[model samples]
Target: MKISFLLHNAYGIGGTITTTFNLAQALATVGHTVEIVSVLRHRERPNFQLDPRVGLRPLVDLRQEKEHPQHLRPAKVFPAAEYRYRQYSELTDERIGACLADIDADVVVGTRPGLNVHLALQAPERVARVGQEHLTLDNHPSRLRTALRRAYRRLDVLTTVTEADAAAYRRKMRLPGVRVEALPNSVPDPALPPADGNAKLVVAAGRLVPVKRYDLLIEAFARVVAERPDWRLRIYGKGEEHDRLRALTESLGLSENVFLMGAAAPMEAEWVKGSIGAAASNFEPFGMTIVEAMRCGLPVVSTDCPYGPGEIIEDGVDGRLVPVGDAAAFGAALLELVQDDERRHRMGRSALDNARRFAPGPVVAQAERLMEEAIEARRAGRPVSQDRAPMRQILVGRGYAARDAVHATGSSALRTVRKGRR
Candidate 1:
């Protein structure tokens, strides 16, 4: 079977790109030919390692392509649905549309909302179009959510990283026949040895964005520092929040202990260096790093975020979960883990065992089975149901209502979720 994945930017180092490559590599290793179609190429080479067997096809090379100077201009057709829509241009629409129209793959899965919209509208009907939701539906802007409820109707399957997000879609959207399922992101076993819970270190990694709430993490880390002065905190990744977070660490007088380790590759090695992994994000769609940390035998101390962390961490067993946005609570959890040697070691071992459920090989195999079923169903002439045509309404009185409240599909009908990602 030939499978192609549509990604926003394969060159970037992110959870989505990392998971996509893992799935592609796993599929290729299992004898299925895989191709990764990157919509935008910003670097000479991808930040993460790619399997030689998986082919890469870049739609737009933004580097130094004199022939396609239009790549430098802004996209006119890029939907307001994406927060980063301004970065795209009219050329992106043409290239993505053309690419979708021409690809001859068995399945073409999209990794983000913008690319998923293209797959819904332009992908060939014979191919199975799967829209992978890497972020929670609640995080989307109202405009984007409306567009998704409409555009995603054409997809044969919509995959969310968590069951909670899947339930949200089933409750809010009215996709009559489209199957909505939760398939967690995969994390391969680390190449390095697992952590032994002896280091006085705590690690957190992600884009340095406000949504990640690194400011809160620094605040919490300050309290942890006062209690355990010997311990160190390392935050890995580069983003716009770098300068602001650096200043915060200085203002709190933790400039020396709390170091901003910018963007480490082969992250598993970094994971194993810490006795405890930390995240204080306001929200996490999948908490991919939690699984990565767990796989390296380090128990996580994370915020019980709405969509992911609560579902990933088994509280007292494998990891500790604190109330969201509470620096005091988050700090207390980290300090408790930092001081207890025996408990930390026990949890770390349990975390490593739990992490096996998300290994790429098994995850991809399950997804491959779903794709095969979809292909067979299509060949059998089962009509893929799409959303109803749009209906506009004018409110003259005190009347406000949620869209599709009555037309929405029941959660029980859509809970055939395959497996937990973390």
Candidate 2:
């Protein structure tokens, strides 16, 4: 089988990029031909390690390509309501559309909303269109949700990282025959040895964004320091909230116990250095870092964030889950694991055992099944079909269609002016 993935940018670091690379590598290892089509490349090389077996084809090399006349213009095909809208342009629409039209693959998967829109509306009807939603449906703005409702009808399958999110999509969004399934991200087992459950260190990793609630983690860790002065907390990752978090740490007088470690790639080594994994996010689409920690034999203590931590962690069995935004509860959970060595070790062992379900083998098998079914359905006369009249609304009222029409009008006028000059 031949599979191609449409990505926004593979050069940057994020959960979506890491999970995509893991799945692509697993698919390639299983004797399937796989390729990743990155839409834009600002750096010479990707931040994360990509498998040698998987081919990477980037359409727009921002570092080397000359400025195009349409590079500054807004994208028509890619939905503007998407969060990454500012990064896309008319040049991307032309490039991605051309690539999709001429693509030679049985299946093409999209990793994000904007790229999914391109795959849905532009990809050849013969190829199986699978749109993978890394984030939940409700997280998107109302305008983006409306745009997706209009465009996603063409997709054969739509996958979410969690079953909770998948249910939300199936219940709220009406994509007639599209198969909405839950496909969690795959995480490969670490090469390093598992943590010994003896270290007095607690580790947390992810972007320093507000939704991650790293500040809350810091405040919670202050309680841990008050009880066990020997234990230390380290946070890895850099973002806009770095200085604010550091200031908070100093103000709390947790400067000795808390250390802000910058970003580290291939964090398996770092995971093994600590005995406990921590996540205090108020909202987590899917807790990728939490699974990484578990795979490395460190039981995570995460907040019961919507749609992720609960699904990943079997509370009190493999890991502990506290109420979201409850600093005292979070601190107490960490201290519970900190004071009791036997329970912590037992949970870490359970964590390592349980996290295997998220490993590449099982996750890849599920993905393969989805792709195979989608392909079989496409090859047959049956395809995802629904009446257009019931769903169709005024294009002018829908956000994306209206903007696309305006862009088309401007382009037409420019073409006419160029012809007159000639």
lDDT of each: 0.82, 0.87
lDDT of 2 by residue, 1-422 (tens): 99999998999989999999999999999899999999999998899989899999999988865377788898998898999998889999999999999999999999999899999999997999999999999999999999999999888889999878988999999888898878888888678889999999999999999999999999998888898999999999989999999999999999999999999998999999999999999999999999999999999999998878987787787789999999999999999999999999999998887777677766676677678878988888475432221111222333324333232222223235445776
lDDT of 2 at 393: 26
Q: Model 2: what TM-score?
A: 0.90
lDDT of 1 by residue, 1-422 (tens): 89999988899888999999989998998799999999889888999989999999898887754246575676644567787786677678889989988889988898988888888888988888888999989999999898888889888888898879988999988776787877778887588899999999999999999989989989998998998889999999999999999999999999879999999987988999899999898889989889899989999999988788876778877899998899999988988888899999999998897666677644664576567766766667574433321111211111312222211122222222212422
Best by TM-score: 2
- The runs of at least 3 residues in candidate 1 whose Cα sits more than 4 Å from the true structure, single-residue gaps closed, are 65-78, 383-422
How do the predictions measure up, each by TM-score?
0.88, 0.90
lDDT of 1 at 280: 92
Clashes of 2: 0
At residue 286, candidate 2 shows an lDDT of 92
